[model samples]
Each structure stands twice: as C-alpha cells, then as structure tokens.
Target: MQETPLCLRVGHFLPYSMSDLNTTDFTNPSTFILVGIPGLEAAHIWISIPFCAMYVIAVLGNFSILFIVRREPSLHGPMFYFLCMLAVTDLVMSTTTIPKMLSIFWFNSREISFSACLTQMYFIHCFSTMESGILVAMAFDRYVAICNPRRHSTILTNSVVAKIGLAVVLRSGILALPYPFLTRRWPYCRTNIIPHFCCGHIAVVKLACADIRINSYYGQFDLFSVIGMDVFFIAMSYTQILRAIFCLPTKDARLKTFGTCISHVCTILVLYIPELFFSLMYRFGHNVPLHFLVLIPSVFHPVPPVLHPIIYGVRTKQIRGRLLQLFTHKEI
Candidate 1:
C-alpha cells in the first residue's frame, strides 16, 4: 500500500491521484495530535497555572457539595438530590476535559488514540447535554415548591427523581451516539492535528476527507432538539414560577422565593454562555477565535462545576449551614 500526500486542510483538500486511494491501505489513522492553542506556542506554560487551578477548584468544590448533601438528612429532599446530581455531573464533565488539557499545556502530551478520542467526545457531550436536562428538572423542582407548595413533596419524591434522573441520562447517552459513529466512518486521509485540547465532535469531524453536509445538518438538528428544547422548557418553568411569585401578597415571601433560584440561574448562565458563544461562532463560519481555542475547553468548562457548588452553598440555607458546620467545627 502506497501512502499519498493527500490531506484535508482548512478551506481546501489537497488533490491526489485516484490510484493513490486505490493503492493505499485505507486503514483509519491510529492516533491524532492535539494542538493546544494553535498559535500560542510560547504561552502554553503561562496558561497552565490558572487552568490547573480551575480544575482543582472544580473537583474540590463539587465533591464538597456532594459530600455535604449526602451526609445531611434534612438536605435529602428533591431539590438537594437534584443538586447532588448536578455536582456529580459537573465533576465528570470538567474532569473529562481539563486533566488532558492541563497535560497538553504543561507537559505537551498531545497525542490521543483514535478510539479513546471518540470515547472522550461521547462522555463530554453526554454529560453536558445531561446537565441541561438536570437544570430543567431543578427548575421543575422550584416550580412545584413555589407554585404548588403542598404537592411539591408528592410530585418530586424519591421515585420521581429516580425516574427523571434515569430519563436525563438515557436521553444524553442515546443522542451522543450518532456523532462518534458518523465520525468513525469518515475517511481521514490527511494530517490528524486537532486544533483543540480535547476531541470535540466538530473539531474531529472537520478533519474528514468525505463530504460533511449531512453531518452538519444532523449536528444542527441534534443541538436544536436537545439543548434548544431544554432551554425553552427551562424558560417556561421560570416564567410560571415568576407569575406564581408575583401573585403572593407579601414582599418578604417573594424575596425569599427568588433567592432560592439565584444559584440555579447563575449555574445556567455559566454553562450556556460560553457554549452558545462557540456554537454560534461555528454555526455561522469556520474560523474560530484564538481565545475559544485556548480558553473554552480548559477554563470555561470548569466554571460551572466550580461555581455551582459555591452559589448553591452560599444561597441555600441548609447546604450553607451544613458546609459551615463541617468547616468550622472545633472538634475537627
């Protein structure tokens, strides 16, 4: 089998003889190189300091939330259960990308196996999508608690959370299957240097030699059906909750109710802003910004994980008191 110099670069595919395709072995590329921060070669080391710190904080903060939620009996209600699940999802989501990103920046270990890259892409997208569903679930939790206080317990009981959690996991896992499957079938006849730290779906897919119109269409369809729909429902839930809050006679009651939602709202903003920014950038055109290359997969990916725990811990009385007890106890 003769290897040809045919590769797919941005905006152009290098030409080669049909004979080369016939003669070449056509086996998939075994590995891909991760080029972290395309042109920022000199600053990779400088970037590592804050990137590493962000990852550590994400892990510790989410874990602390999980531990506090699990140990406290009063916090075992539907709201805290959803929160604990969010912490777990956040831990997995950031940890999936950040460690490898740090390795790429600090140690220059940028090689990833083809199969392993697909696996990472699957879980990364899966947990991210799952978090959206979890947010909607948390919103429903708030909706019921505020909009219909007496039935809140009955509606979001242990059985209900378990079912909602299972549905969220299944939805993400199922939808995440197509991209990696489609990617595996695309022919990679060129240099396999990925421009990001981790194997994002579009990042890896663009390297293919085949026509990717269907892939692009399906990607848009998936995003709208999954993320777009989640956003719609979350907005609807909040709207209903706001209407319910306004109908209350007392200002103190309204303030208290709105306060409960502050943490969730912050979590929503942190998760979606950077993600939607990149999505829109990629949707309109091909060229991605340098900061999106350098910052998103490393820094912003961990922001929700780190921020969610802090926001919830401080805003929610039960979680705040429990966490303070653990930290401030003289016996410890």
Candidate 2:
C-alpha cells in the first residue's frame, strides 16, 4: 500500500487519504507518520492526570448506582431497569477509550494496529448507539408514567421491558456491525496514528486508500439517523409529558409527576446536548479544534451515568431510604 500524497492541507491537520480507505485493503504501507494534536507533550501533562481521575470516579459512580438498584427491591421497575442498562452502557463507554487514552498520554505511545483500531471503533459506535436507544426507551417509559399512569404497569411489564432491552441491544449491534466491516475492508495507505484516543470513524476512515464514498455516506447517514431519530422521539415524548403536566387537574399530581421525571430530564439533556453539538460540529464545523472536539464528548460521556444513580436515589425517597438501610445493615 502506497501512502496518499498530501495534496492540500486543512488547517494544520492533514487528512491521511482523501481517496478511498476501507477494510478490504490488506497491504501495509512502509511509512507510518504521526499526526494529530500539535503539542502532545503539553497535552499529556495538562490533560492526562485529570482525565485519569475522572475515569476512576466514573467507574465507581456507575458501579455504585448499579449496586443500589440491584439490592433495593423497591427500586425494581421500568425506570430502574432502564437506569441499570444505562449504567452498563456508561461502564462500557468510559472503559472503551479512557484507559488507552491515559496510556498514550502518559507514555507518549500513539501507535495502534489496524485490527485494534477497528475493534475500538466498533465498540465506540456500538455503545454510542446503545446509549441513544436506551434514552429513547426511557422517554417512552416516562411518557407512560405521566400521561397514562393508570396503565403504566400493564403497558411496561417485565416481558415488555425485556423486549425493549433486547431490541435496543440488537438494533445497536446491527447498526454498528457495518462500521467494522467498512473499516476492515479499506486498505491502509497512510500512517495509523489516530488523532483522538480511540479509533473514531472520522479518524480511521480518513486513512483509506480505496474509494470511501460508500463508507462515508453510510457513516454520516448512520450518525444522523440514529442520533436524529432518537432525539426527535425523546423530544416528542417530553413535549407530551409537559403538556400533560400542565393539564393535570390537581397541582400536587402535576408536581409529583414532574418531580419523578426531574432526574431523567437532567440526564437526558446532559447526555444529548454534547452529542448533538458533536454531531453538528463534525458534520459542518471544519475549524473545530481536535482537542475541543474530543474534550466535549469525553467530559459528557462519563457524567450522565455517574450522576444518574445519585440523582435518582437521593430524589426518590423510597429508593434513598432502602439504599441507606442497605448501608447501615452492612456496617452493622
């Protein structure tokens, strides 16, 4: 595989191959050049330590949430079910890139194999899709609780919840499968040093020697379709929820319903806003700094899950009481 000549520069960053790059091309080129983040030395020192600390906190926070939900029988419902799934997604999401990122930052090692890069890309996309689907499912659950409270249990039964979980996993799994196939098929021509910590689609596909019209088109389409549709559904569900809250006969009922959804609403905005911005910036904003682009998602990715349990447990009195009971009993 021959490296594609740099024809034109986009800002200081050089795109690996403006031509086709995919998984099918097996030939390894002779030259591997390091590209990305102009000042690695400064970046390593300034960012790595704090990022490592955040990763530890993220892991512990989500783990605590997972345990709280599992041990408390009072918390077992559609809401907590979805919350548990979200915890799992966060666990995978933070674990995906942070460790390797810390390694690269600390050791000045940026080299990654074609196989490993593709694997990282796959998990990143998979977990991202799963997170989106889980948010959509949660919105629907909230809608039922507020709008149609009488039939909430009937509508969101154990079987229905199980099916929703299966559907979310299967949907994300299927959508993400094509990404690895597309990446693995492309021939590697340029250096494999990815700009970001993980093998992001934009970073990896930029190195293809083969025509990547299909891959790029598919990638963009998947990005908008999954993220766009999920956001739309979530927004619609919330809109209806707000309308119902306003129309409720009793002020207390409205307040109660709104209170129940407060944590979820906060989580939704926290998780979705950065995602929305990243999608738009990646698609349209060319001058966006690589560090800025990576930083936005990295900060938000760990947050929703880490704080989700804490918010819901503390706000929901029954769950909080049960969790406190568990802690006191354990100490005893």
Candidate 3:
C-alpha cells in the first residue's frame, strides 16, 4: 500500500471513537465502507459548502416553525398542524443524512458500522416516507376546508389531528422495520464499500452476497404501494377541491381557493419530484455517476424544510401578521 499522506483523514464515520481494527470478523461487528466522491476527491471540500448551508437552514427553519406555531394560537388549524408535521419529517430526513455527509466531505471519514448503517437506513427511509404520508394528510385537511367549510372544524378536531400525526409516525416507522431486520440476516461477502455518503436501501442491498430479489421486490412494492396510495389520495383531494371551487358562484371564490393552494403545490413539488426521480434512477440508471446522482437528491432533501415556512408562514396572512407583530413588540 502507498504511504498515506499526513492529512489522510480516513477514519470510521461516527461521532464516537472506535479503534481502527473495527471490522467484520470475530473481533468486531460488520463495517460497511462509504466511498465518498470517487475519481473527484479533489472536489469534496467545495462540494460540502452548499450541503452544509442547506442542512443548517433546514434545522433552523424547522425549529423556528415549531416554535412559532406553538407560540401563536391563531395558527392552530389542521393545515398548519400538518405543516408542522411535514417540517418535523423534513428535519429528521435531513439530519439522518447530512452530518455524516458533511463528515465524509470535510474530514474524509466514510466507514460506518453495520448496525449503525442499518439504523441510518431505517430512519432515512422512514422519515421520507413519513413526509409523503403527512402530505396526504395535509391534502385531506385542504379538501375538507375547501369542500365542506362548514364541517371542517367538526371533522378535523385537535384529537383528529393528533390521530393523523400518530398514524403517520406509525405507518412510516412500522412498515420500514422489516427491511433493515431482513437485510441484517444476509451474508455480505462482497466488498463492503457503499458508493454513497450515507446508507441507502438499494446501496446496502447491492453489497450483499445472498440473493436480494425478495428484499428488492418488497422494498419497491412498499415504496410504490404506501407512497403511491398517499399520492393517489392527494391527487383525489385536489380534484375534489377544484370541483368545489368551480361550483362556487363567483370567479373571486375560485381565485381565493387557487391562492390557498399555491404553497401546497410548491411544497409537493419540492418533496416528491426529486424523490421520484431518485427512486427511478436507482432502479434503472446504472451508468449515472455516483457523485452527480447523490448530489441531486441530497440537494433536494432539505428544500422543503427550509422553504416550507418561508412559503406557508410568510404568505399566510394571519401567521405573517402575528410574526411581524411579535418582532415589533419585542423590539420595544
């Protein structure tokens, strides 16, 4: 082996300290190596700049949304509540991938333990799935508010919102449990290198020695079915919403509903468009460069959390007024 440089920053990827001997053998558990920016190691420093910016903004943006929503009583409606949930899931998804991603780009640390990788894989998938689930719920909230304005409050009470939140958490978390558990049982006899900064389901499966047809099929099925259902419901809700708006007697009413939906449409595009593209590319595009491929989804991962409140909170009259009023009063 070539003598490593003094700045050879290759170390196991984790917050805690572990010996260099940590590996898959009788002495230690399995370790999957993360290949960070192969053939373009020179650009890792420049690559992390925007990624770190996005991560910090996402965390701060989501935290601020949670705080502002809790502080103001006027923002206690179901739509905002579901927006809060979306912010939370975005935070989880970003956090699951970004810190280690930054580590790989900054310090060149890319080794991750098997158990830790599995946990990371679980949460990364889980929270993303949860985001879509919450979006569907948000669509239901909008549908009720627009279609049956009189019964909106009656149908979507605080209890109902809480239930929807719980259901989103459970569905995303529980259904994703099997993939990690089963993947662990497989014999990963091939080289342990994962060609990404973080643990992804398809990446991890590709490293296994045993047949992964079951896991692949199950993952794809679960991905499409659970997330597909959410997409279907969201589409139907919007369709009904449009129907209700058109049935109104005045063009002003239709415009009003259109204005209300702008933020939601933007949010949906930010959350799903990149995600769907990532899923499809992983399934079919073997020729794609890992550096470019990873960059695409990683860039979009934080867009929703960082932009949601800016779009929804800043544009919504009540929330904007309250935020401005708070700042003005505090300045005194």
lDDT (CA) per prediction: 0.79, 0.74, 0.77
Better of 1 and 2 by TM-score: 1
Q: Candidate 3: how large is its RMSD?
A: 5.7
Residue-level lDDT of model 1, residues 26-75, one tens digit each, is 44878877777665656889988887887788888889988987787888
**Candidates in order: C-alpha RMSD to true structure:** 5.0, 4.8, 5.7
Per-model tally of clashing residue pairs: 0, 13, 0
lDDT digits (tens) for residues 1-332 of candidate 3? 11121012233323333343433433223787776654456777897888888888888777877887888887888988998888788788888888998898888788899899999999987888888898899889889989898999999999999999999999999988987887788776435666677888877777665677888888888878976898899999999999998898899978988788888888888878777888888766656755566667666666777787778767677767766776687531
Per lDDT, what order, best first? 1, 3, 2
Please report the candidate that would top lDDT against the real structure. 1
Candidate 1 clashing pairs, residues 3+ apart or interchain: none
Candidate achieving higher lDDT, 1 or 2: 1
What's model 2's TM-score?
Answer: 0.84
Which candidate has the highest TM-score of all? 1
Q: For candidate 1, which ten residues in a row score worst on lDDT?
A: 2-11
Candidate 2 stretches with Cα past 4 Å from truth are 1-38, 322-332
